[model samples]
Target: MKKIAIISALLPLAAGLCGAAGKKPADDAVARANGIAFKFYAAEAQKPGNVFFSPYSMYTAFAMAYEGAAGSTAKEIASVFSFPAKTKDLRAGLGAIKKDLERAAKDAEFVQANSFWAQKDFKFLPAYLKTLRSAYGADAMQADFLGKTEAARRGINAWTENKTRGKIRELFPQGSLDQLTRLVLVNAVYFKGRWKAPFKKEMTSEADFTLDGGTKTRVHMMAAPGTREAEYGETGELQAVRLPYAGGGLSMLVLLPKEGRTLADLERSFSPEKLEEIRKGLFNQKVKVFLPRFKFSSGYKLNGALAGLGMPEAFTDKADFSGMEKGKRLYIQTAFHKAFVEVSEEGTEAAAATGVAMGLKSMVMDFAVFRADRPFMFFIEDPKSGLVLFMGRMQNPAAQ
Candidate 1:
């Protein structure tokens, strides 16, 4: 029995919004990663409440696809992601960031996995496969995508479920894969950590959580024990707080809109520079914190969203992925993603998985008395690298 190789790809994170002056290759890559994180957030925000997804997972999956793209296909991807000019540079930059993430994850449980699944008899350029193996450490697995499509789909889903500790399942869905599917690239990320100053269970109680339009609902609002010192800051728009995990390297950053300010206002003005400034302004202070214990999962077929973001060619016949194969040009067929998150008095656990079928194209916070009684943004990140492992907004903890 041939087994799929498990690649220790580490994970991804972000802080800076755009490419700043005097930055190294890895720093540039991280900045681009953060850029896409917000870009995707804006696209998703157009929809209604409670948006969440792992930027690192989605970025990693598409990065692999970009390796096998050529001509305008590659250019569009590079432009959308702000990828490094050279393929070798992109690989090296992402690899360096992965190592740093691994180092920072000692006190937390952070796992990243990548896989390349191909049609049993399909031929792909050795260089294309080599890039995935060497750069992303993704090992290939054979599947009869043209024959036993359902079995192939189930196998992939099972692998994803196991990798995510059962948090994500059925990523491809029935009929999502077909005979034209020649390749599938997958990236899954999982993070588990306990807050440094956890809220006492006794402090949790039912409270009214304000919703959009000033409507309210009951939620299990958790309170910090007395006045706990945390990284706190405030601006005219919002209040920010950093909740460190057991290991000092990773922490959750929460941004709560000011009393009269709407989350939409803070979101519209949110930028990398603003985030950096807020971070720089944070000071350790004893603060009263109230947050709702919430759990929710999100799923999306990112094809339309990616195309809308300026990479429409990747999904059409005009797309050129000749770098993957010479005779038959390949275009993206399907792009799928699923994510889950849980925030409680004890800690937080988040998992996300992304799959980009070659036939496809697709594709936080803060606090204050610091009370998040309404919708707020949150990020699970490596404070040092500014890598966001997971991020989302809590609209209604009562719903899930």
Candidate 2:
């Protein structure tokens, strides 16, 4: 007899209708909360140089895994991610956003995909699998982790690479997964879109960009073909602007620290509430835009960072994820994330992938020339949903 029983069997669902028995939050509130959570995440994980990652990707992957977690392990994850107090609400809210994002994709080449893989020999709770499949659109696929660890790793990496249009590769690094691995949850998000008003390639020129420490470096600065009307705002601390993508639904919100201030200063004081204030303060006006053309990729081993965010129990043996399976407990073994982004005269192309290996646990902008000659923060987001697709900072575009 089979140790694990497949109830409904994995089937593709149009949207996540995870079987949580509560009302979902109202009007993109879950996405907004995730955005706010990312603000706190940035404050904790950001370093001195260029930094980029997809909070959306991380949130979705973790949310899928969180569905299978039990006890304090689940509570810690909720605290760290700012998930809704009710499991049903969180699932419903995320499902709504997932459906909305799919609809929004018509305006841009935006794609988000998720999958859940379990060791075929292991026994997981049927309810856990059902919630993941229904609420997250992640069908459960049985993998031979004990006998084919390498093959399993390759299979997961290939799925991520394909979903991200070849932008992100090898999300599970060498030796990252081993025989003890029993489950893996993955999420990939990719976006390619042109600006509503693109900068003419001819207008791009070599310019001196000042670093926070008074160091100056040469960078290819892109300029809008001419003055354009965009969402703009400024406080005594910084200048902010919104550059819409091809569709008005999404935009890059850029925040530039004032002359006497530094990126660190802006980051240190930032919060989701503050971001809301900035969004409310913006006005539409014609402004000059100056952005640097840069491309870079960032990868992180998220165990330490996530622990620092107050979810230490998820990685330790004390973790209770019995909801995933009835027998031996599974703790997070590894959490990995990789992101790639390129901003240029034509538009922007960005991709990100996040993976959770059981054994496992883991872990924008804008414009305003509105000139980004100095270091600044940027976010690619859905103005209507208040979902931030990407968040990053450009310290030295010349670095990579």
Candidate 3:
């Protein structure tokens, strides 16, 4: 989906208010959704340096997390992710989920109740009408609909601009938005920091990268000797690595196609469940990493992928968004997602509050530098919510 603009006025009035509140739980939900979305994207991007993440997965995860929090009829929640032929299955899913939440509620019940509306509804059973009215005014509700539509557009544009450093424009195009839209949520997190150890420009040299179909391309490679955690795993035929962030709380998982393996194979096998497995199996180890400072821009149309994932109803005019109003005509017209990412180990400098060098050299260093010259995957997440707001893979930096 090149331009994904979901305007969901039917998003249970309570959910919309909770989402708009910008509370910790909402933020956490967004982040977790982002993380799940990124994993799917990374798996797809692992193909032969031509990988593009799926926007459908990102949108689905976001909708699911929101549904998990907002108390909506099982059918309503499923509609947000896509439509289901049998509402029974959705109710079953919700029943199973409710049981899980009931157990979790026993401990940290207060925090859970406050953070999750579903839990709140089950526990306190607040007056839904009063909460809805207080949380959203008529004007605010109208504005929310308009704001979500525009925000979705802005998000795709921002990701494209940020990743490509301003190469792609209007990923969704103009006039792609329409009313009766069911849902629109976006998360844009960026990290532009320096490396603890900078690469020497003179040491950078041309290197051969194995591409798909037994092809080879000469690219500039940077090498650094540092204590870094690395891993090797498989998403079908693709080989991947997990690079931890500075705090070790989160990691950047990079997937690369094995020699002769196409990126498509990896994308086909990508899923949130698989990603969680990969994350759990990641182990910390020391290694000498060699990578290129590369940049590349990509655009994707995710309608097909999303529809394939059991969310087919939102795409058509037949979509029922009655919750938005007793009688209203609304459906998602289009979904477009475009993103760009550049990774280069070029030197970067930053100032710190304390300037001290507690080393053998005893020299005061007031700045930090970084050079990202390798194809890498990265995300910034909240430790509590486990959300990943921003994610990208950079294969070529100069081109971007």
CA RMSD, predictions in order: 6.6, 7.9, 14.5
State the lDDT of candidate 3 residue by residue for 288-392, as single tens digits.
Answer: 456675554454444454455445544444444343323324343444444444445642211000000000000012211122333334432222233433344
> lDDT for every model?
0.77, 0.75, 0.37
Q: Report the backbone clash tally of model 2.
A: 18
The residue ranges of model 2 lying beyond 4 angstroms of the native Cα positions read 1-28, 31-40, 43-46, 360-369
lDDT of 2 by residue, 69-179 (tens): 778888988888777667787777776877766665567898888888888857677888888777778856778777998998888888888888898888888888887
Clashes of each: 22, 18, 35
TM-score of each: 0.92, 0.89, 0.53
Residue runs of model 1 more than 4 Å from their true location after superposition:
1-24, 360-368
Candidate that would win on TM-score: 1
Rank candidates, TM-score, best first.
1, 2, 3
